[model samples]
Target: MDGPRTLVVSGASRGIGRHVAMRAQAAGWRVIGLARQTDAGAPFEMRACDVADSAAVRETFRALRGEPRLHGLVNAAGIASMNLLLATPPETMRRLVEVNLLGTMYCCAEMGRLLARRRGGRIVNFSTIAVALGLRGEAAYVAAKSGVEGFSRAFAREMADFAVTVNTIAPGPVETDLIRHVPKGQIDAIVARQVVPRMAEAEDVWQLVAFLLGDAAAMMSGQVLHVGGA
Candidate 1:
């Protein structure tokens, strides 16, 4: 709700996370980007962090304790998986959960604790429309994203009294590196199914994230907003 605030955005090296961090800075918010790689174009401070690493994440937050209090958190780090359930390697599925589900949970827990101390903050988590649309060959991804959704809702409930809002953004088909490995035919089919008749852009999703983190969305919480372009 404040005019200028600090926001911690995960996966800010690229894709929707990158756009959100850049846009937030442009809007006068101080942005902190967390990723495994440094981003040359990041508008604010950049911290190379692997969200999947619990110890590293804890240390990162501890190091930031003396800085300005965080006003928002965006959990945008994620991994994609697409394969027949029977053919999908068990290890691959485990990794997917580790990165997508567990990573988000870790960030939320740490960030939520800090935000609660401030008595007000916002959290925007990344989910997937695949969880709602039930795309084939995406059982693992869908499951992980679904876990994110559930976690966001429950976390929202637990943090509401503190004025910390938590919500999930379920994006459809966004043009990002994560989708590069997806078959072209499948990508085309997904686009064809959209009412917009084109892939969702990272900027498009970033707008929603900005809104959620802004004062205009203060009344909302525990919602799974679907940016399916449908």
Candidate 2:
């Protein structure tokens, strides 16, 4: 691509998505953000579109079809809740799948089309260490994230012909609002299992994200890189 690169980041209203959007903009990429609600102070353009809604994702991407140099997508829009499998309500599991799994799929489908049209792009989807750790009390969350990992690998293979690389980041617990409701003891236990033995910092994950979105990672696809050394 000869012109300025553009990237779309989902879940940009807060947490990891917000950080990625801000940092990517600072790095000179034209950033477009998507979330259910818009952030007034966001430095990049923020679009209100819930990724879990397939129709909303289609419309959002349609609106951005004219963007030049569209180069990447970062799917960081996700939700998590802790509950034992038996105790978890049907609605909770459905919601988890909706936002965490289906959300990623919907965005990837829309962005995948755009990237395929351009003949190349990178897609980074977020997962969780819970899936790898087989953590109890988070069966639904783990299942949803597991789907993300599996889907990314398959999607990567399919998109390879178009030079579109798909990869995943599965980070251990971070002190984001996503974990605010989780018990401190449980969080500590999860951290203790990591070789690094500490809760992840936002920067730790962002560094990997920056690389995956950069030119150096062009050959890296269908990979699940875990942070915190879990």
Candidate 3:
């Protein structure tokens, strides 16, 4: 009898991460959620963690490594900021780089190690359309997402030897709490740039996640998929 496939998703407390967790569970995967909330209230396993903190990520994955079978990972933990380069505060810059770049790196490092042993697994990461559009007032966010894209491409090749695929999904803009902070005018500008010209729903993003997690995507690696028709 085959047991349930396992997947780890960071930032699982809310936003895209939470939505992914729900979708994965519905797809019959055992989802392990990692977030900062101790009581992240969910059916699947929840590990309280701050992915930005390297030590915490290391520890969380260390425990997860002991699982009987690990099949997938989603590095969805990230932060967004909107400010001109001149106006962007140093603290915000540090946080953007820390939570977005460093967090993804740390999760990828630990999860990649475990998934490699499986000889077959999937790793999906989140990027943003800003990285491609060079959107104004998002210098810090764009820089961090650029790092994620680069890391995903390079790491895909490195992990291929182990039959593990790594890919990134860059959503134009979704109706998540993450978007509430942005100015409405700026949001409208981004929407106008998309071919779809509409807010991305949770399912819109999950469609790609499901495909990437499916066996059909075995040959798809090192790709950066743009959503919302960007």
- Count of backbone clashes, every candidate in sequence: 0, 0, 0
TM-score of each: 0.94, 0.97, 0.97
Candidate 3 lDDT tens digits, 106-209: 99899888988878899999999999899888888999999999999999999999999999999998888898888788888898899889878878999999
Model 3, position 59, has a per-residue lDDT of 93
Model 1: per-residue Cα lDDT over 1-230, one tens digit each = 44468899999998888888888888888889999998776668899899989988888777766556578999998889789888999999998998999999989888878888889999999998788778889999888999999999999999998999999998888989889899889988877766667778888898899899988998999999988654
Please give the RMSD of candidate 3 to the true structure: 1.1
Could you tell me the lDDT of residue 131 within candidate 2? 88
Compared with the true structure, the alpha-carbon lDDT of candidate 3 equals: 0.90
Best by lDDT: 2
On TM-score, the leading prediction is 2
Clashing pairs in 2: none
User: Mind sharing the TM-score for model 2?
Assistant: 0.97
Give the lDDT of residue 9 in candidate 2: 95
Q: What RMSD does each model have against the real structure?
A: 1.8, 1.0, 1.1
- For each candidate, the alpha-carbon lDDT, in order, equals 0.87, 0.92, 0.90
* Per-residue lDDT over 85-184 for candidate 2, one digit per residue giving the tens place of the 0 to 100 score: 9999999999999999999999999999999999999999999999889999999999999999999999999999999999999999987889999889
Rank candidates, TM-score, best first. 2, 3, 1
